[model samples]
Target: MCMAHKSCVSEADSAAAAAALFAWGANSYGQLGLGHKEDVLLPQRLSNFCEPGCIKSVTGGGGHSAAVTGRKAKPSSLLVAKNQGKTCALYITSIGSGNVDVILQRGSPWTAGVLIIISNIRRSSLLPPFMCLVCCILLLYDCPDGGSLFVCGLNKDGQLGLGHTEDVLCFTICKPLLGCPIRQVACGWDFTIMLTVSGSVFQWGTGLASSGRRLCAGQTLPLFLTAKEPSRVMGLEDSTAVCVVAGSDHSASLTDTGELYVWGRNKHGQLASLAAFLLLPQRIDARCFQDEKVTAVWSGWTHLVAQTETGKVFTWGRADYGQLGRRLESPEGQKPHKQDSQLTFWRPQSSVSLPLCCLTGAAKISCGSEHNLAVISDKCFSWGWNEHGMCGDGTESNVWTPSPVQALQSPSRILLVGCGAGHSLALCQLPALSEPCQDVKVIYTLQADTGNPESQNGMNKERNRKERQSVTSTQSNSDRTRNEGP
Candidate 1:
């Protein structure tokens, strides 16, 4: 899977970078982006992305699905926007370096409206002539590449980020995130989490606060009490967030340093805390993950999937639907139940209770409402809810253990997999004739490289030269022995 903050160039070059998008499952609101509202039992190629290398990432929520499309733009481009009715010329330079020096001029004090500069660029510096007045409203997000965000499906709660709650019948540009170069988007039941090129995160739609709990008991609170427009998540300013993920009623963000912060509803202990709600970001205890740096994380409706550097998969939260991908243990001398629906909850009591390891060697993982998909050793494995064949097992039964999706065991290498509420999407790259089964040999590390590309190329060339020399030596030795007739 592509790292949440991967550069557009790297994403396009990836073996799994989605040249075409394939989706199956629920399409009640046309979230499938297939130009129809009918449900698809089998995976079907999305006509919208007929052009190879157009699709970057795919995500969905309760009933809406979205995809990030477009290749990386040229290194730098002059962006022109009207700020406070004064024509502003903004010269953004060195975007590919991840740190940009934005030079804006001829712009007076800003008034209403926020200008979000989204690119796949990195860190940013605001130069002279760029100023926000007392009445000016300006919001800028940075990243390194340029791309478009498209959404289709239910917008009952504005999950599509289109600035309205009307259900979308076809793929539409998310207006709020339109200008910003998006790195990726994570969808919740009624909200959306957007990550920009600059490692900034924004959220919109109804709040993710819990509906079952009152702040102090006997107190009533509004069900949807969050931003209607995209708002930056405040606490994340301290650290650059590389990845953002969302559950049915909660969300989480991961920093480049491997810190995971969670918020929203905790009714099912999805936040790893006993509190009923977390209005702000809170760090999950490292001990819960065995004190290992979590390299990646994915979420279901009420469960979470985390992978460590060692590729061990850790899971927590609701397990009734077999979403946890592990068997629940009972008290001493008591046997675990055969049926998962009645199993005890896997709530972590502080850091004392740790999340259980479901599987190992998971290179990447994606979670649906109650199902998960992982690419292990170049093959895809699935578990949990199979109703609607979201697990891609050609069955409607819930999967109790990690099982290989026979349909995905193809000659093409599985580059990445994504899951919506009741559907699945896989980004694969077919093998070239020159390199047979090269997908198995090349591991998708998904880690961002900060080194110079030229230097990397030089290293690759050196390694290839050594490999050729070794091959030639072996062949020469074989020939010499054959000539000696010994």
Candidate 2:
């Protein structure tokens, strides 16, 4: 189920501005796109969406916002009738639980578009109740031409691929894509990129993995690269990828050959001793681990996690915060105990440890800002930061080892899992209504916002005003109520 905010508008100019500013969830750093650096307890109007002949879109990030707009026009026939009539078109889209209302001086506004929300789901209601909350969303679009927009990560640089640098509270189409037909899109924190069916890759946004500098702070255009010569990634020739996943500053691609290639940032050993940042993809050697057939891979800010076809997980990179889930004893004077008796007091190789033993039966995994979670068949486990009760163990302490989240100890079966900077979400298949089913419960323990209860209530009042506007119009309220998920 989903939780969202709602809004509505009546003026064209006001709608144009309102389409540019809005916020939901945590607004620390103005990431909600509300044009301010304050937390919004509830949905409130960032601006009015009553502009005539206006085209607009908005998106959200970890702590930032983005928006786009274009010229507007009225239908010629409608204009002729309005010369004797009085009516205008209103365009509206809902992202998360927040409602977006846009006014246009034209024919009927596009009724079919896409909606994206950053929220979460629970994997199992049977687990013991804990406070960990997952963040993700649903993507509803009407691209009848068989096109799809891939949504993951935040746009640190217009890289959410929504054609703007603003945080997208909802799903916005990647506009004006040309030449190669984009089959999928992926995002790193400050960058956005796309892969085409023709084996070509396009990239935009911030940071040069090679120079360690910004390639383009915020890009709206797609830049194509020829994976030949110096720009070519190793071991990708004649190979096609089936899936791609991005982390905070890195990315990974899975080939049809069951091979995995990774690129981008490597601080904290996320890239397995590749010193400098990788501008091109490099093949991962699965033979180094017991599992040779990798079925899935995931990443966090500074670490890597992957699952094999046999339900095994392998992790590398930063162990700080236990992101890697590997056991490590504090070093004694910068040296570790020697396990080999053949060596005579020799220094151990500077190598990162891999915890192949700890990650058994893990079918899926997710990484938060500083923590990690894994789903083993019907059960879920978490490690790392618990500061906001993200670990779901009902404590504010951090765990350096993997621990089962007792809060999820219900009888339902979990299907999917996701994580935000400090929160987590799971999707579970509950028992049918005819059977004994439990209500899907959501728990929030993130740092609470400091604000007067009256002020918070006032925000809700504004949200109610917007909802009333939407009801007065012909748009369906079903879009606004999608946040009530299970």
Candidate 3:
């Protein structure tokens, strides 16, 4: 059983410096990676990252954190930046002791210039004894090398891809997947699935079709979706999938062509259907907007959201807790609206309103266990499940409609956004300015030989002087703050 997940990258890298920050929740077993067992309600920068060669990418599991860095290339000696221009490198780092284990690698043939980190966590009961076992297991995979599928966590239903349903505490290499190279893996609460470079889907873990109804509970071995029979999924054969994401009971896929497909538990209309489950992939049809194309897909515990190429956002499935971001009025409105019964199969629904329709450019989108977030034109907006202030609106009110996060107002420019079960993460881009030095005169001698007299005389000298002074003040302020430290 193989489990895989995908994340987006921010495109603001420079030759000089870079930084990565994280925040987490539910840290009973030290899974928050804060070097402590307390849950954090706000974003906190990881300690001891003041060095130059910092992190480049980060991924979070149930309770564990993983990062890829460029620090290994640099020697132990601290290389100071000349002219205040810092040279950056990458390094892999972690905190805490239990629940999950992370590994980082650089100079890979497959990814070439890319840096990758694989994170694996062993899911177990929250009891003290179980927690200790999980911690011990996390130590083994502190660092993994080469291209291999690392398996950890609950194997009760073969979700660990170990060919058995026994619990696994340590990370184990996956068996050869029928000689077919596995490019990625994804895990549901009790199931695991893999996708090959050829766009084939293989699944293992509980609730599979095998077991002759007696084994109907779950399986402990890999099962091909097209092995003995054809999958009921339509329009999947020709589509080239770029990524896959899974929820507790459902999963979603985004193709290279920007098409979205979903399957699994449909209760609460999550599958957009009236049936109980979709045994196959179902393409989401948004009507007249079919050509819009989906650039990203995020699956939550009981709901799903998709971002289109035109910056139009659409959500369907569960709306009970307002995860759909659709406004619901009382039954006594101008026209009575009937609540659709819980659906079990895949059906299409529309969520476009004035605000969403007016949105022109959306760069990224992420979904929490129940909430939804998006970075539209470098601005942040959130909706659904704000009980713990995960929406970052400075309040715990649940919003049934999309609302801009006020806490992230002026000074903070959000470069990237990520959403976890009940928490959120943001990478902010601070303004850059140079230090104030001796004011050297930038002489602009007028060319007396110019044919036009107006060209020789400086146009709007007062305006130009004022602009230069304003720029100098901003640069001086920025320099002072940088020297003072973050």
lDDT of 2: 0.46
Q: Identify the superior model by TM-score, candidate 1 or candidate 3.
A: 3
- Tens digits of per-residue lDDT for model 2, 412-466: 4444454545545444433333222222222222224512243234335544665
Each model's number of backbone clashes? 14, 63, 23
Best by TM-score: 3
Clashes of 1: 14
Most lDDT-accurate candidate: 1
How many Å off is the CA of 182 in candidate 3? Answer: 3.3
Model 2 — TM-score against the truth? 0.54
Candidate 3 structure quality by residue, lDDT tens digits, 1-486:
000111222343332223334443345445445567655433444433333234444444344444444454332221211112333333334443432333323331222112121223444332112221111112111112323455555555566556666675544555544344455566565556566666666555554433322322343222332232111134467787877777666667778877677766665556554445666678765452446877766676667776677767767656655677775443321222233455343233422211254234667677766777777666666777765555544345566666555434334455666665555655544332232321212122333352323223322342365478779999999999999999
Candidate 1 overall lDDT versus native: 0.56
lDDT of 1 by residue, 1-486 (tens): 000011132333344433444566655555566666665544555543334344455555445454433343221222334456653333211111112222333442322112221211111121112111101012333312254455554556566566676765443445666567666676665677778888998887764533534553554433333565677887788888889887767889988888889888876667877677776678887776778888888877788888777777778777666777765564331232222477564444321224445467776788877788888887777778766656654445677667665544456567678776666777666443333232222221212461324323433543465568779999999999999995
Error of 2 at 62 (Å): 3.6
TM-score of every model? Answer: 0.55, 0.54, 0.62
